[model samples]
Target: MAMPAAEIEALIRAALPDAEVEITDLAGDGDHYAARVVSESFRGKSLVQRHKLVYEALGGRMGGELHALQLKTEVPN
Candidate 1:
């Protein structure tokens, strides 16, 4: 099963309402995606913690419905 980009964005937004999310379909396939998420919530958090927040938003779909995600997270300037 594959997840849509909009759904992924929606999920992240739902978790971090202030987030700025950009989703890209890496291989033009729904299974592979790249996401850039920026939010104040990521401020002061470690790299691993920032990623955990995004994964938590996805609700455990990372390896199931979502095959691969190249994720980047940052605190806004």
Candidate 2:
């Protein structure tokens, strides 16, 4: 089963309440997604750490329910 975009957004938001998350269906197949996440909490976090946060928010659904995710994270300037 593929993870819904809303679920993705909700999960991220649950973890980072001040995040601005945008999810795109890259292949229009619901399994592949591209997400741009902007959050104040990511301000001082390393790139790897930021990605880890997003992955953690997904709750281990990455290679199972969700096939591929092209993720980008940024902190507000």
Candidate 3:
């Protein structure tokens, strides 16, 4: 199964309303993606925590509807 990039962005934004999310189709396949997310909510969080937030936003879609993701997280300057 494959998930749409816009749906991924929407899921993340639903969790982090202030997040700036960019989703890329790395292999030109909907199942593989790279995402860069920046949010003020990540300021005090660690790298693992930030990723957890994004993953959580996906609602368990990883390894299922979404096959793979290369993720990067950042806090706003």
Identify the candidate with maximal TM-score: 1
TM-score of each: 0.98, 0.96, 0.98
Q: lDDT for each of the candidates? A: 0.97, 0.95, 0.96
Residue-pair clash count for candidate 1: 0
- Stretches of candidate 3 off by over 4 Å are none
Q: How many residue pairs clash in all the candidates, one count each?
A: 0, 0, 0
Which is better, 2 or 3, measured by TM-score? 3
Model 1: per-residue lDDT, tens digit, 1-77? 88999999999999999999999999987999999999999999999999999999999999999999999999999
Q: Is candidate 1 or candidate 3 better by TM-score?
A: 1
Off by over 4 Å in 1: none
For residues 2-50, what per-residue lDDT tens digits would candidate 3 score against the true structure? Answer: 8999999999999999999999999987999999999999999999999
